[model samples]
Target: MTTKTSDSPLPWPPAAEQLPPHLRLMGIAAAKWVVQPVYVLAKLGAADHLAEEELSTAALADRLKVRCDPLRRCLRAAASVGIFRETEQDHWALTDTADHLRTDAQMSLRDFTVLLGEAPMWAPFGHIMDVMRQDTPAFDAVHGQPMYAHLAEDDELARTYHGAWSSLTEGVMRALTTAYDFSRFATIADLGGGDGTALRILLATHPQLRGILMDLSHSGEIHQGADRAFEERLRTVSGRLPDDVPPGADAYFLKNTLHCLSPDLVLQTLRRIRSEMTRPEQRLLIVEGVVQQGNGFDWSKLMDIEVMVNNGGREHSLEEWRTLLSQSGFRLTSAREVLHPQWLLEAEAA
Candidate 1:
């Protein structure tokens, strides 16, 4: 079956800025609690079961083999957040937003929700203050290892982490491909392209373009199945950045990869990519969340905190991005906001 695709995300929740000062503060403080019920709903596969048919809380609880009262509360909490709806006194049905929570739904966030609630990802936030004080990532301080190293040691966590990213990439690729002209580049290399979701989309959209998927190591698993035709035009390479970059691509992509690295590492990676550009026409495209200025509501501002806590990385502003690119022997050519806060930054060797 052809899975549905979405180029844009669901609308953001109503802003709390309109509320009274005390109520806004209270809502801000209580916001963290909201994820708990949503996590429970995703963890329980409630959306999948609900997709079969709307059922009363008692019946749904029995079907899921969980306590009725707690399940009912979770359903109600989720409903309050627009994830579900209570049709009758106890009857519940999936909302349009809830449909994306289903495991089989295209670009499903079930694993992403699970990842958010998992201790490795969630527990670090509680120590954000400590992390800020020490200049160490909370994930490393709490887990005794870097996030990537920890993932390497835990198979289940690694699957969920990669799966969450892959699912997210599927949703974002449409916008990225649409915003940027990939047809200009004959062969594009996706550095740190996990599971080749972005490449698949690029190749599918621009039929004449070929792609190289380079990562730390190839997982040998193609998401959503790349047929023999796609395989004929795509090549997978196992390598790390600042050293193992594949040569001969017309353009290179570093989507959502640089933000996970330190400033020095980002420079090194970019310098290496700059050195690898044999032709003056070769370009480097970076896709990342660009943190906006001011205290206004920007998703990247919140994501900045998440990355700071989870890894020693950050979302960069437009000025910071230009400075970084200049320092790495590259010139920032263009930066377009393709998917809300996520920007497509095009650069070339200085």
Candidate 2:
């Protein structure tokens, strides 16, 4: 929900107090471009196609089956944000932002773009009103099913939706890998770990350690692993939590997944993990973006709204996470805010 600023005033629109007739009368129309152009280019696979070669507006429009004029404007807007580059004579190429969308790029976010634009993803916005009116999750109104069920039922959505986390969590994964030593934990369960992206990183570090990716059984091999030994230590398990924690798993990892639920629900998730702790030394490490206090962030605030509409959820303050874990009978063993700013909290069975 933390949106990229594209000439749009993010903190919110200015007060309509006073304005010259031309500008004031138009009033806050700038915010609309941020919403429209992003979806347009995202759907076009603009970056994916451009990865091979720069394309002129006419060619890009032809590839996407659209008219040239509006497409040119969309491309220009994205270029202003440095997502795409206007090379010369209207041709466009990829920048770091566009690099994320390529099919074979070291870092690809095609899935993220696809998920963000899909109806299951966008439909929640339509019911934001209902969420405000009834103080509940808007997903049911949007999909006629629980969010989890909807994700499970629609494979395309489930894959793309889950991959958005892959794109977003890559930063946190680096923070975690850099901040902690994984060699200590003999066995780990990456709870709700979609494609085992985190496990891939941890296994490579620990060498002797083994990991269980407990979520979608079909989270296809994340491309060809660069490290074969690490790939061997990692195993995929299709199932829910508690049951999914493989035998002898002394370590549990639940990232980004925790803050999406209410405190009571978090308690249940913790209790389930606690039930699987075979030894007193077993621990649960959760990585999530904590809702920081004091300074306000557009990401946290807008994500707060996103969670509310999608799951009746919100990111937690560190204290809120601690309380949630404590209520579920876990003791906070250590807490670290990774240098990247996304906080990682580790807890142990009390």
Q: Which candidate has the top score in TM-score? A: 1
lDDT of 2 by residue, 16-37 (tens): 4545555644545665455457
Clashing pairs in 1: none
Each prediction's whole-model lDDT (CA): 0.83, 0.72
Can you tell me which runs of candidate 2 are displaced by over 4 Å?
1-32, 80-82, 85-88, 216-232, 241-247, 339-341
Per-residue lDDT over 1-350 for candidate 1, one digit per residue giving the tens place of the 0 to 100 score: 21222223322243555566677677667866678888888888888888877789988889889999998888877777677778767888877788888998887999889889887899999998897589789999999999877876888887887878888887788988767787789999999887788898899999999999997553556544668899999988888766778989999998898888878888899888888897899999998988887888898888888788898888899999999999988999998888776789999889
* Model 1 spans > 4 angstroms off: 1-19
In terms of lDDT, the poorest run of 10 residues in model 1 is 1-10
TM-score of 2: 0.82
